[model samples]
Target chain A: MATGEVKVLGSWSSPYVMRARIALHIKSVNYKFIEEKLSEGKSELLLKSNPVYKKIPVLIHGDKPVNESLIIIQYIDDTWPSAPSILPSDPYERAVARFWAAYLDEKWFPSVTSVGIADEEEAKKAGISQMEEGLALMEEAFGKCSKGKGFFGGDEIGFLDIAFGSFLGWLRVTEKINGIGLIDEAKTPALVSWAERFCSHAAVKDVMPDFDKLTEFGKMLFPKIRALAGTR
Target chain B: MATGEVKVLGSWSSPYVMRARIALHIKSVNYKFIEEKLSEGKSELLLKSNPVYKKIPVLIHGDKPVNESLIIIQYIDDTWPSAPSILPSDPYERAVARFWAAYLDEKWFPSVTSVGIADEEEAKKAGISQMEEGLALMEEAFGKCSKGKGFFGGDEIGFLDIAFGSFLGWLRVTEKINGIGLIDEAKTPALVSWAERFCSHAAVKDVMPDFDKLTEFGKMLFPKIRALAGTR
Candidate 1:
């Protein structure tokens, strides 16, 4: 049960950070979680561990630090080659999973995040529209990947599941603030169900941030996001 | 030795496509290379294989297709777990390689590409400055990664080597057209040497497109890139 000395440097609300935690939890890897107070300033350790990005969700196994959430998850899978694999065993399936995960981070997540931070109505509308299109594509992907199973990993949570599931908390907050069910049952029914199952899963249930708390956190952060948007 | 029936859908000019080719060559996997005539329009097979991105460098083994250059490289390593591994066997090393690869694609490549396409003097200057800064960082990275060895994989070409090396053809073209050595020996001596070794490596020598031909191709593409830049 003792899988090496693992440590995770993260912030409570970062979906990216949650990915590392969720993967560790699923792998049954005991790790010390160090919460970084990003609003104040990045810690020296975080800065040292990831000098290039200076970001969080850095997984330190022993003395070696692995940055980037998806890469960290892959590391977890590789380092601990056990059942409930984070990535698929088959090369083709693994590639497909990675592709979707990349799509979620690179394309879909941006549009969804923009919807929350955009000050202008036109920009927000555009963000929403794009987000909807991304979700529709994801809906089709889920049907293909899941093959009438409960999760993206088929029976249990896998790479793509954690990739998207980590963002569910923020999505919930987005829904509350925007007064729109972003993952509407009629639109993305499978994802709606998958979100519910993902949140309730043993490894995830405890790790997921409380809905009201995240909403409160979002309220404090939205102003800063809007200000950052203006400068860009 | 004959491996599985493998095929690579690619465009000759793409650095991404070259990553897959280089990895395959290193692995000694016999694969049919099908060039996608981008200007002529994407082939139906290319479009079907990679519906999500609709991009080149989709590796087909048997019937399953793996998209994305880095992912395809990982797939090659996974499917062919022999010596001369493309990715470092150690999990931490693999993560570090993946991080640098992502940085090359997402950050460094864009700045370098912008220098070639930017029409405005100020924009081109900005691109060059940023590209130089990126090269300087990469120079430091090569030192840490290579550890006094010949390449990023330390004596043999590996993931980060291919990750950065795939762009050497484009970099050479960029250098010729811009009239500046972006990877200058004065600025990044280690990279300058690494570039020489990488280009001449047996696996890479034939795979790397001819310099003059690529330069001519760049001249044809630069106008289109500038036009695209105007829209963005």
Candidate 2:
């Protein structure tokens, strides 16, 4: 049940790219990582593969190209429907997973990403406040979704895990840049432990970038992130 | 096999709400449509159901609430799974459907909505330009997706059909408000025909709000839509 010529067109430091790579890793699917040199400009392959958005993390399977990180993850799960299922089998659980994943991408990640790069001190504080509020909600969600297990996907690192887990590197980078503790022991006890288990897990151990490296990466991208933040 | 109560928490004029309702109709599921008076502020039930977004078109199946229009549509398809699938069975096609649906929601819809309500002439022209650009891309997509068939689903209504079809009402409203045609016969002849076919289809015919009613509704919400446009 092996796939033929699976490739991921992405840059090294993107959390979105990590989601696709992590999903591939979890499914035990071997894929070639074709890094896009986005600083120079998007690779011709990336532009051709994803013409509409012209964005990174395009999953090239055979000749078909899948765009968007979440869609790519779902595609991998659907294409390789075997052991180590990414999304839950139950209809309701799958819906819940999709709901939370959307929240992480659409709401939570932006708040966290804004904290370190925002221009005004007031904006940074507001970003931190929003990040904390989002964390509290995620904390409650973890309790409900995990059902007393160690991970959001229960024992295994499933959809929600890869989703929120992908941001762990960026989260760490944010914390290092701001000198703050986001996943606090007092506020989110379960997530504090869950983050440790997720990063060290066999599938994710080497996949997540080093904290210091990501912090340096974050510093370099500060002007660019700030410029782009307003556009979003 | 109908087991329990189904209720839709929605405002009648909303395109997103139409998506949930149309998906239900396609499945022949009888459900109560509870009109939320959103102008008076959100109801307690709506807030409780979707605490994060605090937004509408929540599909309450028995007591469980599914938030977000796209998620609700997917949830409905997953829960029913019997006849007339909303999303395609094939994974690749499903991914493509999700991709276009995301594009419509995140990119195209915003462009079209802005054209009529933008405060300045420059902004309005920009909106029209973006709208045409999006329509051109969608026209190309419709050709590839429909594949010489009457609909995107090829003889049946499906995920992309529901996604784009929901917006036809709003597109018409935008046209009426701006006194300009967004879906041009010369530029987007496929979409022009598809819109007619979609509006006349049984599942969509009764579900889409009347054009005049929606036009009046848009006028009433001009100030509100303009205010929210900047935030997004």
Predicted model with the maximum DockQ: 1
Identify the candidate with maximal lDDT.
Answer: 1
Tens digits of per-residue lDDT for model 2, A80-161? 8898999988777788899999999999998987786889999999999999998999899999999999988988999999
lDDT of each structure? 0.89, 0.88
**Which segments of candidate 1 are over 4 A away from where they belong?**
A1-4, B1-4
**Which candidate comes out best when scored by TM-score?**
2
lDDT of 2 by residue, B1-232 (tens): 1247999999888889999999999899899998999668899999998888888899888788888899889888988889899898889888998999999999999887777678999999998899889889888888888889988877788989999989888888888888898787878999988988999999989888988888888888887877887789
Clash-forming residue pairs, model 2: none
Instruction: List residue ranges in candidate 2 displaced over 4 A.
Output: A1-3, A227-232, B1-3, B227-232
Least accurate stretch of 10 residues (summed lDDT) in model 2 chain B? B1-10
| CAPRI classification of candidate 2 | medium
TM-score for each candidate, following the candidate numbering: 0.94, 0.96
- For model 1, residues B1-232, the per-residue Cα lDDT tens digits are 1246999999888999999999999999898999898768999999999998899889988888889999999889989989888888777778888999999999989987888888888989998898888888999989888989999999899999999999989888988998988887789999989999999999999889999999999999999888986889
**lDDT (tens digit, per residue) of candidate 1 on A1-232:** 1246899999889999999999989999888999998767999999998988999889888778898999999999988888888898777778889999999999988987888888889999999898889889888989999999999999999999999999899888988999987798889999999999999999999889999999998988988888987889
What's the residue-level lDDT of A135 in candidate 2? 90
